[model samples]
Target: MKLTLTPSTIHPPFGRYAHGVKATGSGILVASGQLGIGPDGTVPADAEAQARICMDSIVAILREGGLTLGDVVRLNAFVTHHDYFAPYMAVRDEYLADLRQKPASTLVVAAGLSRPEFLVEIEATAVF
Candidate 1:
């Protein structure tokens, strides 16, 4: 079972996410950091495109574990530049829009990633 929490004492989450999640299940799925590489191994230069690809990759991986984004308890997003934040957030919101149980998420601007063309990388944890 999974419990999503949002205490009245604190301000509601700024975006599509929960304050926290409590899970009591045997399956704990941890996904590796996923880059924005496409099927042809091409990385898009634009932040929005890269963000979308990253989210798509995460969804595909979650399905392999018999879970969806709704089951994700946490997400860690890494971007190469701070300017990419808005675009990344937009894409993330689109992907998680329908999920009733959102995950706690953190976004950080990193100096670089494994590849220069990689604009964003997203990692996730899901319990189901």
Candidate 2:
């Protein structure tokens, strides 16, 4: 089982995530940051679509590791704009809503990413 923690010392988390997580399992999967590019190497213009693709990539990696989205203990998202948070979170919730253990998460608004067309990049850590 994984443990999610939110200490009283810190302010409450702003979104659907914990402040920390303690994972249990012998296997630990660390997924690289995944961009919005799809199989055809095309990125969508909308941040919501890009976020969905990024989550799909992350789920694929987790499956390859013999895990599921529920096994994720942490997620780090990099976005090009602060306004993208709502769209990104919408997609995130759509994907992660069924998870029994909510993961620790962080979203950073970067000045720019590797490619201008890429609106979001997401990375994850899981144990199972």
Candidate 2, residue 85: the lDDT equals: 95
Alpha carbon lDDT of residue 18, candidate 1? 51
lDDT (Cα, tens digit) per residue for candidate 1, span 36-100: 77766677889899888778767766665567899889999999998999999999999889998
Q: Output the lDDT of residue 127, model 2.
A: 76
For residues 1-128, write the lDDT of model 2, one tens digit per residue. 55554444323434576534445564566766777877666778999999988888777666645678898889999999999999999999889888777999999999998778888988888876
For each candidate in turn, the TM-score is: 0.78, 0.79
Pairs in steric clash, model 2: none
Mark the regions of model 1 whose C-alpha exceeds 4 Å error after superposition. Answer: 1-26
Error (Å) of candidate 2 at residue 23 is 14
Q: Give lDDT: candidate 1, residue 30.
A: 68
